[model samples]
Target: MDKRLLDILCCPVTKSPVRLLAENELLALNRAIAADQVLNGAGARVTGAFSGGLITRDARTIYRVEDDIPVMLADEAVATSQLTDFPRS
Candidate 1:
């Protein structure tokens, strides 16, 4: 992600600052996805793992970056609370 874009992007719901997910954090999220345990705010299953992502500062939600494009849709945000073992920053 571009520094300028990351600086400007914020969580659509919380309006909180967003930061790139750390390697460990991304791994944990992917593990949860593989278990079929990750879900979007809209209650839809997150069937695919993110190659990259931005997470809200509060760690409440995450927006996936696919092919270098950020999926900023509110409904597409994955709730961290749904993960069995949520990663800490």
Candidate 2:
């Protein structure tokens, strides 16, 4: 993701600043998705793993990046709290 774009993007729901998800964080998220344990805020099961993602600065939510495009919809946001064994690093 471009630095300028990241600087301007914010979580659609909380209006909070957004940042790229760290490698470990992405790994943890993917792990959960692989287990079919992750869901969007709209209660829809997340069927695919994210190749890239933007996480809210507060770390409460994540928006997936597909084909290098960020999916910023609130209903598509995945709650970070839902992932078990989330990596701290």
Candidate 3:
């Protein structure tokens, strides 16, 4: 992700600053996704693996990044609280 773009990106709903998802966190999320255990805020199952993602500073929400573009829509957001064992750091 570009530094300038990331610096200005924020969660659409909470308006919280966003940052790149960490390696460990991404791995964990992918694992859950593989198991068909992940869903978006809209209650739709997230079937595809994210190539990259951005998470809110508070770690409450996650937005998938596809082809270097962040899917910042509220309905597309994933709530970290739903993950069975999400890493906070």
Q: Candidate 2 overall Cα lDDT vs. reference? A: 0.90
Worst 10 residues of 2 by lDDT: 80-89
lDDT of 1 by residue, 1-89 (tens): 89999999998777999999888889999999999888887889989989999999899888999987899999999988877687665
How far residue 37's Cα lies from its native spot in candidate 2, in Å, is 0.5
Worst 10 residues of 3 by lDDT: 80-89
Model 1: lDDT of residue 28 = 90
Q: TM-score, each model?
A: 0.94, 0.94, 0.96
lDDT of 2 by residue, 1-89 (tens): 78998889998877999989999999999999999999998999999989999999888899999887899999999998998877653
Measured by lDDT, the strongest candidate is 3
Q: What range of 10 consecutive residues in model 1 has the weakest lDDT sum?
A: 80-89
lDDT against true structure, model 3? 0.91
By TM-score, rank the candidates, best first: 3, 2, 1
TM-score of 2: 0.94
Clashes of each: 0, 0, 0
